[model samples]
Target: MDRKQIINDPQTGNKGEAFEAYDDIPANPNLQRTIGDVIAARYGRRELLKGILGVSATTALFGATALSAPRPSAAAVSPEQGRYNFAELQWGNDETHHVADGYDADILLRWGDPITADAPEFDVMNQSAEAQLKQFGYNNDYVGFVPLNEEGSRGLLCVNHEYTNEEVMFPGLGRQDRADFAGMTRELVDTEMAAHGGSVVEIARGNDGKWQVVRDGKMNRRISPLHTEMTIDGPAAGHPRMQTSADPTGTRVIGTLNNCAGGMTPWGTWLMAEENFHGYFWTDKLDEDGKPDLSEQPEAEQMKRYGAPGRWYAWGKYHDRFNIDKEPNELNRFGWVVEVDPRNPDATPVKHTALGRFRHEGAETTVSSSGRLVVYMGDDARFDYQYKYVSDGVVSEDPAANARLLSEGTLYVARFDEDGSLTWLPLVHGEGPLTAENGFASQADVLIDTRLAADALGATPMDRPEDAQPRGDGTAYVMLTNNTRREADQVDAANPRAESSFGHIIEIKEAGGDHAATHGHWSILVKCGDPALAEVGAEWNPETSENGWFGSPDNCAFDAEGRLWVSTDQGSGWGKTGKSDGLYGVETEGELRGHSKLFFRCPVGGELCGPYFTPDNETLFLAVQHPGTDGTKALKGFERASTFEDPATRWPDFDPKMPPRPSVVVVTRQGGGKIAV
Candidate 1:
């Protein structure tokens, strides 16, 4: 294969399908604007009035009058009600996790930590599939802390192990090379598979207010891709497209793959998103006769648009189930949202198809005024559309009844309008262009080919939509992670930057404060960039103040007081500058509205993720993924080899002799008070 072809192909490149249509459209001279011009034209008038009144006009229109009230300037919180105090930290590229000055942080869990008695202690040079199955998986992404007792001292810490950094996971597997395929072994492949799911570990807060994992606790369990069984539910469960030779019923799968950012449901189940799972399979593997068997696949074009490059990992060589040419339907069974009840270890995890399927980032849910359950989700691929699933029935107090609600909801794709308004285009069968004549034969077909249906309906394509978080005040915020492939003509009011190296966050006010509302109004909350740079800076000019600017916002969450907290995933551009990926907090309301401050920074080459807060808003838990993943680039004398001999980063363990390992970090105030206060 030509490296240039792979580099230029939207499906095979770093931009993924988000830039699939970039070359097809020409640049629009009128759409091009300098950073200052764009910021002034977009927020000048609105922010002027907001600055004077200390509240957005839109917030007033929505009747959130409390947001306009005057408040203290210090970082103080009421014990009864969780509120955030503003504090700023300077950015640095140190090989350690940095937190606010008054706050203290410590590593809570690291990859390969033994969760059960059967699991062996972590041995970097001698890891096995069986050992990994009983331990914490690799690359923890989303973190959810669910209290088991009323005092909140005991709880279940649920985390999603997104994907493995193969080079770092195995002992001698340096940078990935085609020649290394000849030396791949079953043990290596199995170990990789065992590290791709989620983990539920029992945790207890000590008298000192620090959290620790309880080894061999009753709730401690690892849901790995090696042995866990998952049930397929919803309208598409028994569809022929999901059937496979291994499971003729088409209603069961062996495991979950690429479990990324996730959320905790109101009923207390973990909703994990299966993202970038396609890269694990080998679709174009050669047959016994040395001929490509994936040439005739019916959904070849569709698969390409979903970023299925021929044989990236070639796991098919070790496992027949991963060979798409041999079992095409197996790929279809992996992209849905899988829900797990941490309280019941024996409960069967489920993949809810009613939410529809793509490269799901996760599902953030809120109940509508009418009592219907509404779930907001994002398709993490570039140029993909944002979606939401609105349950047809009302939520119930019974957990069993609530579990069935997601299996019977309507999935809709978003279409942002030019006038700062957006409409949810329902992807229901027999609706508008989604009919048999257009190839959608049933509801399952519509759900299976969700992206195609959305494209046919002319839904607006967005920069990689990462996380959609809803606030208690009836508005939701969606992050459009930077789209480096966006052209001038592709520029829209919502995504104003052409080659958007730095992304923006959009605030959506659901119509009538209803989560189930089909029509909503939206506005760009912040156009993220370096405030010191004149080309793509924050509108408020944060560079002059303690509040520094950031880019490529990935995972986000709202604090107890409804403040927006953002974490960045800076791609290949890491380490070129002095800045490392970090977590930042911004005031969404009151006198400090529109102000952003850097709260914490990850180590070199690490992306900050899973910024979840405790119910009391005292402790903040976050995941630092892929630290020192310089990958052959010798930046600051750090080489990208994954072997323990020539490791790039020795994080968590600051020893210069050890290799870097991804881990979850917990942050809290040193004086036993609320965080950020």
Candidate 2:
């Protein structure tokens, strides 16, 4: 697939085609755009300042002294104070990770790093599927560090290998050559499959405070597309839609693909979201009868709305499971949150279907006031709805009991009102439009066609909702990544920008400070873009300062002190403004509220993901994915050449002659006290 072309196309880029396909369907009249409009108009200016600053004296509060001086003590200050005290890093095109002045960063692990004793060392020239399965996979995105001891000396580092950059993975192939899928070798396809999934490696902090992977640790494991048993659980499990020849019972799946932004469960498990799983399947090809098989499928329209393509990676040529024509039900088995227990290497990972299937960015959980587990998720596509799953059972003290919490839940899609309030529309079978008359025969059917159900409920379409995270203070923050295809008619108070190229962050304060609140109030945290392009009547001001402005906010996290940290994924827009993708810190409260600062910049053509902070707030971990991807340009014909002898970014290796490797980086204050203090 030509990723660059896909991102550039206004109609098809970032799931635009899917949104258009579902746009004509009438939304529920009760959930129309009136509420969003009223909310935006009423709070456009007044609430914008108050929501962020929490005080009236904005100018006096955010004066030079606040930006220049050290923060007050934790007890005397707000959560944002002292968390982002570092100087903002400047924008640069360098092929290296740049951090703040008082901090140091180093590569902790890279693509192909050995995770087990039997795994061979990384050798770019002699790579194989067997080797990749025993090593770290490609494109690390969501990262979760689970501590094993109170001292924080040893921990399990769980990283999601979102997808592979095939052009860079192969020795001779480039983007242009990737179009000739028929000419590609099966071994190459297998290798690519081996590189897609997640990794679990034990890492330890040395006495010197640097972190390194424990190669021989018993907990070290790699779950890839090549070989892994994932049990399907919840409403959709055992349904006819999920049954395949390989799994006639419909209770098992081969592996998880395109695992993206993820979260750690309270029960000590990793929930990896299968984002863009549709790109791995080819559905529109001819069947044995020489007819377009996708057109004959009962769920064809649903597949189209989910962004199923005619021919994508062409993995079907190498594996029958990836060919929808041969195994039509295989695609239905994916696109759910797969749970993996990193602490137990022998455990069988599970695909939780109660969360409802969509283009999931990932799942973040927060305990509701009622003691139920509230799982927040975003379908990572333009115009997709944000969803939440509330467990019917209360969280249990026993890990065994808590593990089953996600299996039974009520899935709800969000509807933002004009008065800045949000409602969770139930996507249950027999509920409103989701009746048997509308093709939903059971709860499983409703969960399987979650997007359709949400659309039927008139859920507010968002600007590519990516990561939804809850803070310790009961409010959750969601990153609305850029959506260039959104039109003026689709704009609402919640999604104010018609063509949201730069994106924004939204703050959701759950009603009664409960994560499972069916109703909530929301506010725009920041309208992220170059301020010079700000339009009239904008609800919030665009980012103005050179030190703060950024675009395409993707992964996010809250520090121990409650400050928000964000990372940018600048797809094809890399280096467009001479600014590279970076990690940023924003003050959500206190005198410096609404102030954002760039903390670290990624290498050329790279995205900064998995911005996780340790419990002690002493270390920050980030994933730099797909550096040097822009080295080659697409050509008219299926032919191209590498821009240089090696990849454009040598990054952590710091060698121009070596291929750029995506790696996990750790940052800490040089003086060894708590970070940012």
Candidate 3:
């Protein structure tokens, strides 16, 4: 199918899924060698790791040079042995979410739920933009906790509301993007803007060990794209390209949008990573096929590289700033990590420009062994690059002093080699190819057009890298989500499968156990898919059950004990796996390495996200987004578009008057002890 046909197809459920199809065309320009060619050239140790990727895949991902290095300290001698002790939950598609046998998954917050004491109760029929600004935002993706007390019983919850699902989120409005957005009005667009960005609320554990929102708490606040004002900091803060008519200073911008996976800094700050910002931009001009027309745009080349003026939302049609024809530089102000202080509501959020702009999936931070702050990031596109930002200043006990770490960091892109060695190429202006001749006139210019600069630096193009989590031991895990659009001649060693359905994970051990190091060793942790299919090249521990294996590893985290937990988001493609998206605990060390077990499962059409565990490991928080709308066409009996008035399931509340609201679920043990001990 053609690009326009794929996005306009009848099977396309929502604009988000349509955007995924729209992004099938990669932004990277260099694709000389495919994965098949590399695998065909080298053919050693292909049998040893058959336990993982099978013989169909060669030793390109797990070469001897990297595998021969010392394994993790917790390595086990057998696949059946590991530290996790919970009974695996069987996976299946259903209308309601499911958890393990010994856990209680309770709904803590839902879309439009009243979060402030003065906020009115949610009335779906009478929804208004003014009301949504005070209530819980829609489609929560990232869940973070900041402790407010010594016992860790009381804390502030920071959550990111990714995007709105108009089909299931509104009353009479059907799919708008396919209908030329005729149904989208100014009020609806304003409500969607109010729903974007992040939320901060105070919570406390009761005597019964249940967490409840403190509606009247002093820290309760909402950060929305409609009205939230943010300050820009770092090298590219005051660049000419960042200036707009409304903001001549070029150091301030209004609100954050498309806030996806985020992180909690060591000094108690929330890092909101912006993804898919290009989709929110609007363009009045369209070609004969109704696609964005950028022929006469001044910054057409730079905007096309990032897929700007995506027309995913109608906000730009109603608001001048979002309209690219009027303010071309407004698009550049976004796509960076915004740091927010959860403890203080009045503090203005800062967009750290030192962390290069891209479709950032996650901004997970960890203090290096030498005390410098290191943030592991992934650009979530088909052939985008993974990045790292190392702070020049060391972290100290003072919380205020650590706040500047992100603003003064050196950004580097990864270059994974076939020899299993990884190199971090610095994206420094006036260094190497990043000079005046290559379009980088200054450091600010390099930071403004990060993707263009990285392309010149010879960075390795990855297969949809998303949500990288770095542990205290300087070991980082990267989730390479599947890239089905990959053709036969476009594959590489890191991404071995052409037309890859099931994605894989890469384990990186930083050089000298330092996250800020310039070098590292990378090995394939697991090639995720059904182990029963050898043609799929899936590698799993013999102990993995039918329900243990999963696909499209999206967001991931490490528990207090250093165990890796992954959440999947297959969208409409979940039909291929015949299982609902959920949370899985995969063993990364010792004998049980590559073994996976299902812990929690989402309802049909819902994507699991933000699997966060408390410091005590007693409470696990998960975000179930866009329930009952994603891929309902693949559902066995319900084979049609689900509207807000006629959803497949009324989850959480299950009330006939309510729709399937996106919610945040809190999972706790039955008897109130450390989980899965």
Query: By summed lDDT, which 10 consecutive residues of candidate 3 come out lowest?
Result: 71-80
Error of 2 at 602 (Å): 0.1
Q: Per-residue lDDT tens digits of candidate 1, residues 1-677? A: 24334334423212211122332221112223222233334444344222211345334322243354433333332222223454567777766788878888899999888988777888877889889988888889999989999888889999999877665566666434334255568888888888879899998889998989899789889897779999999989989999999999999999898888988988999999987776676755545542234568887755655555335454787777888768878878877899999999999899998988788887888889998988889987656778999999888898768978889879998877655577899999998999999989999988877778887777766767889998866799898877766655544334555667777777788899998999998766666775445555343322214335677788999876667898987655553335788888755554344446778998876788899988888888999977766322434665433354555567988665457888999998887877765
What TM-scores do the predictions have? 0.87, 0.88, 0.95
Backbone atom clashes (below 3 Å) for every candidate: 4, 5, 7
lDDT per residue for candidate 2 within 380-414, as digits (tens), equals: 87767789999998887888779889998799998
**Per-residue lDDT of 131-180 in model 3, one digit per residue for the tens?**
99899999999999998998999999999999999988888888888777
State the C-alpha lDDT per candidate.
Answer: 0.73, 0.74, 0.85
Report the candidate with higher lDDT, 1 versus 2. 2
Model 3 regions more than 4 Å off: 1-3, 33-80
